[model samples]
Target: MDTVRETTSAIKLLEQENIPYTLHSYPTENGPVAAVDVAAYFGYAPERLFKTLVTSDHKGGYYVFCLPAEKRMDLKKAASVVGVKNLQMLKPEIFEELTGYTHGGCSPFGLRTKLPIYVDHSANNWDAIYVSGGKVGYLVEVQPKVLENLVDAQYAEFTK
Candidate 1:
């Protein structure tokens, strides 16, 4: 028997807005799958897949960042883009509680709270990009502009 996939909040939001997206799923035996591994499993170039990261400012304000799976976020640049003195990655322990999504499954869309989102400027190079589908084992392909509009994201040079 085939397992039925339940719609994630991210998917629901996209559907409600009439945005086009494609869902891709992969099997997992171990714990949370890394974004790079997911991109490999789907036979996609690293630049075609992006990952969502949550960070907090010194004052405890939260922000979300989306960047290519192959790149590391430049904390200093990210802080500047977010208009904070400094920013740090949120603790893994509070990831799910704060974002309502698991560590490897966070999406900029449909977060537990409305937070400022930043997407790496490089994403503009692609007509479409894949991001987590608000769950492990799945990804959603969408146009960058639609995603940015839906999440009120700003594009910036935040990746190193």
Candidate 2:
């Protein structure tokens, strides 16, 4: 099945930038599938699969954090790095409005409006990592530095 979002603008951005990525698809379900599930199903290392999380301040401003599947984001630490007093996961509606993509389909690659991106320091340690392909049950493999180089993502200590 084609789990990738057919109408996502992220795909076009990738094509325009000539960024190489491997598209992966698995069975889509209603519930959340952890990044480990993707790694196991695709025969890749769990450490190499990343999950994109949307977090925000009290205002409308938001940030995208790309981290490893097994590691939990340290919200407090992240907030400190971003120089905000508080931060929390963005609501689904807010996410849709900001990125023009559904919760499971959100990709840092293409957004309706460009927002600041923060990559967990750990991600840079790896040569390649797997991220969302703008849809549920789909993943894209790319070099870790691409987030910073291509997306202008900042490096931060987002993990506890």
- Candidate with top lDDT is 1
Task: State the weakest 10-residue window (summed lDDT) of model 1.
Answer: 1-10
lDDT accuracy of residue 60 in candidate 1: 84
Clash-forming residue pairs, model 1: none
- Per-residue lDDT of model 2, residues 1-160, tens digit only: 3543564576677778899877777777753487777777878877788888889998767889887787888999988988898999998767888888888767888878788988878777788888888877667778887888888999888785
Residues 9-93 of candidate 1 have per-residue lDDT tens digits of: 8878888998898888777677337778778877899898999999998898999999999999999999999898999999988
The 10 consecutive residues of candidate 2 with the worst lDDT sum are 1-10
Runs of candidate 1 exceeding 4 Å displacement? 1-3
> What TM-score should be assigned to candidate 2?
0.89
Name the lDDT of candidate 1: 0.87
In model 2, which residue pairs have backbone atoms overlapping below 3 Å?
Answer: none
Clashes of 2: 0
